[model samples]
Target: MDLIEELMQEITLNNFDVGSSTWVDVTYINNPHSFYVRPTSYRSFLKSMQAHGQKLEQQDLQLSMNIVYYSKTLKNFCRGLIYHVDTAKKNCTCDIYAIDYGCVEKSVSLKNMYSPLLEQGLPPLATHCQLANCEPKNGLWKDKEIDAMKCYIGTEKAKLIVKGKTCLKLIVELFNSCPDDIATMLALTGYSTLGYNENVFSRIPNFKQEKHYYTYPKIEPGNVLHVRTQSGKDLDNFYVAKVDEYYDYINNVNNLLAYSKQAQSLRPEDMKENKAISVFVPQFLRYERGIIQKITVSEEKALVQLVD
Candidate 1:
């Protein structure tokens, strides 16, 4: 017989307790409900050992077992079975309780038992929002638009923005100072770019400082003015109107629209292909109520606006 078979035979012959109450309890009661195995019967013991070996293999671990002996009746049954295992190169030990006053005990040996491999895995690192394919619907803010804008700024530009070095906040502050023409405001705000070719303001010309031949009235609350570009075909105009009741709603809707369009048009695909660039909308004014409305745009004339 093989060494394993010899060891099994010796354990079975020496520790077998066919008539003991503990053997009956382990075989009939505990084995049915728990992992307890009474190896007094050869067939049952071999089957249990086989199952245990399969379990260890599934977990990518190794283990080994042996029989112990002790005399009992007094001393609170000091004798118990020991199962030794290794995990991550560290020795781990488990003690099995002795249920009967027997001189011999039987146990199984297992090698390299890696239980973590058999357990459930960990959750993903990035959330659903972080995934490129995930779309979050109906939130206080559009996550996709925000994420796209972040991507456009690239990692470097984002650092500058975080440090408050970007011109977005300054532009918003200038637009909100008072009722003024776009060019005048830009000049007063020290942004020659508004009237110059390289200036960011050239994209939105509807609010130009140049006087119009058509008579225009002063902007006020309750006036729904459609600020359209010179060609009137492009909706790149600022509508100077008051929405006292639904001002918040209009602002949110407008900001979301602006960010959405910016994200879509200025997506990395468009930029890499020499298309339009995406602009970042200042977060401070994303929900602020104000007098003059401002729309910033990219060099390609794509509109970027403050909703309120």
Candidate 2:
């Protein structure tokens, strides 16, 4: 595959989502229950943004790719930098400006912007925004091809490690399934690619910065996984274990956590910091909005008690 480009100008009006919690980071200090910017006002706003960063001499505003109404109760106007606009989709990704990371996009973005161009046999120039809202959602050829490449490389690597040898079986349950944890499990002994998560597996290149990944799919439940130990251990002289054993252990641990006040945390690191979790695993803390119990299994259930 071609080299990665850190940031691609692909966010367009089509991709621009309106709402503080959804897409755009621009939020009104006052949550106006109702807000509406007339389409005409939106049209004008776009024109004014088109030539924003050009220069004082270049008197044109880059059409705004995004907009967020601060308040519906009062009309307040504030201007911000023109990051990108997508006219066809009638959306903008202005929320990126709020990112403290210097408004920089990543290398994988180029693939999103130019995949169609590559398909159309056109030279790729993703330095600027993809023509906004003009084309229908199309295939990401470059990105797909890259994933295909990774699959091939990963499968081959997995095969090489399991060749004629299965000693100590290791099954890891992630306490926190973030990118870091996903990557960590993938780097297990004897085989770095012996792990998979549906979400993190898709963005392997973005996270691991690698061209390939592999997983042992046939190593299913009830299957014994064996591995070699330290010195003096023969090739097959190792420990054997089943995948269900790991799950059962995790379930028991989760059960123990529920009753333990100190169990009220997620990751090992966070567990250390959480006085409650340090005391017990499944323990809960009494709060006004509902109790914040230990996130026994996954990160998604961490703070779900707070709901409006």
Candidate 3:
């Protein structure tokens, strides 16, 4: 590989120290401790991907070269950095890092890889990062906490305050105009607690600053609530909000009704033991016609044999 290719490889393989603040799009969040970010500066990678995809459609790329390959996976074609290869196998498979997406795809077939050009000189688009000065409450990240973290930053860009670097990930604080940074927010939410990372501990906003940040008043006794009155007579009227719970109940009923309707619609006459229907094969990510060989009515499950 040439100098640029070598440099790019080194940069991608190592975590780049970013001791500054920048705007980043949060790509993946496994937990508060681990996540991926695509900085605004790396937005050009998107254009490169677009052009590469067009070329892929034209069938104009080689099948394999240096460390990089255009890999086709269940998720579709993307630039990949080869992580592992088994040359001994008759039909070799490779483990590759999906550079733009920041995820490792394992056992990718050799046939699905294509040679990549070195001219792009683009390093991995996604930067691995961890929320600094925060530790999970139970010394582990659970699904509930992960879900909460996802809900907090759903599809939104955040201000990334990169504090330090680890071997694999950058230690950072991430937030988007809340009462506190994500690290503190996790602690406040009882999913995590503040750790003893001096780099971030000293930088954490004080209580005065936290109070200055906008937060809704807690719903408690003796809180004044204004309501529109018939004659504008009542100034202190309160109402408990149940809009979310009400909608959740309605949705549950609707889903139950829909499921019951579908189950009933699958009558013996409508769908016999050997009924033919279009089935979506998730494995191949496509639709195919199949014969229903067996149906477990109670379980709402079916054994479908593809017509082939």
Candidate 4:
């Protein structure tokens, strides 16, 4: 059978086509209205990727870039496309785009690449979908909206009611145990605004899509000064401790900066109860863990409690 036809047949069997209401795992949420889903029983599509994937060597990176390859990104092998190759060094790494999840991994090593099978023509396993007839109030997504969706959709399976489809993505409404369903719950709680007429996830603006690389401190000898050690063993392990401290300090500062930036951009209306956030405590003089307990937009005040 033709590949597309076979794929459609499987999608129908899984009840993932339009007018099908099935339980799906809400995997990744790009925004309040945009998310990715995997049917509880995705079936043969996953099995084919796992059973037919073939590993490749460093010399095979160029040829593998043009086709779908299995990338061992940690534990599970992901079907991805290598978009760029870093060939300046002897051992090259590539930037890979995981089609199913709609995410990217940079500087991936050659060992992760796996050549595609000759007959591997199926759509991405994770279906790109969006909440039907719903959008954010300000025409943008915030951390709160994303957080709300995560809370509503927890680890349990979500109901995907496929209303229709666009040229690329499915127009759907996701529902949990909430009385109003995901869309109505968001709207009632003010996390999202209603009146969206079509599938808008594709047209919605993504938040902070730019990527930046940082220069990390090397742990090799003579790379950094201040070599103090109590014994030979301590001396040998000095670089490791130093590097760990360097990363810890960098991470802490970055966290503080990110929190401050997000906080500044937020209005009183954006604050929601039980929303996870980082706050600068005057007594501690550093960013500390906190959860918003109460929001009073009229008073421009929120009661936040620090938590472990």
| Best model number under TM-score | 4
Q: In candidate 4, how many clashes are counted?
A: 0
TM-scores, each model vs. reference:
0.14, 0.13, 0.49, 0.53
Runs of candidate 2 exceeding 4 Å displacement: 1-180, 188-308
| Best model per lDDT | 4
Once fitted onto the true fold, the runs of candidate 4 whose alpha carbons sit more than 4 angstroms away are: 1-8, 12-17, 43-48, 51-55, 63-75, 116-119, 197-308
Give each model's whole-structure lDDT: 0.25, 0.22, 0.57, 0.61
Structural RMSD, model 4: 19.1
130-217, model 3: which lDDT tens digit per residue?
Answer: 7888887776899998998888787777999877653346678888867788888877888888877533335555565212112234
Arranged by TM-score, best first: 4, 3, 1, 2
Pairs that collide, model 3:
62-115
Model 2: per-residue Cα lDDT over 1-308, one tens digit each: 22122112121122112111111111111111110111111232222222222111112323211222221122222222223333333322211121111122211111122111111111111111111111111322234333422332231111001011001111112112233332233333212333234221122444544222123246757865632121235656543324334322221222232123222334544422122322322232221122344566444444333210
What is the RMSD, in Å, between candidate 3 and the native fold over all Cα?
23.4
Q: Least accurate stretch of 10 residues (summed lDDT) in model 3?
A: 250-259
Q: Candidate 1 vs candidate 4: which has greater lDDT?
A: 4
Cα shift from native, residue 37, model 3 (Å): 1.4
Between the candidate structures 3 and 4, which one is better when assessed by TM-score?
A: 4
Q: In terms of lDDT, which candidate is stronger, 1 or 2?
A: 1
Point out the worst 10-residue segment of candidate 2 by lDDT.
159-168
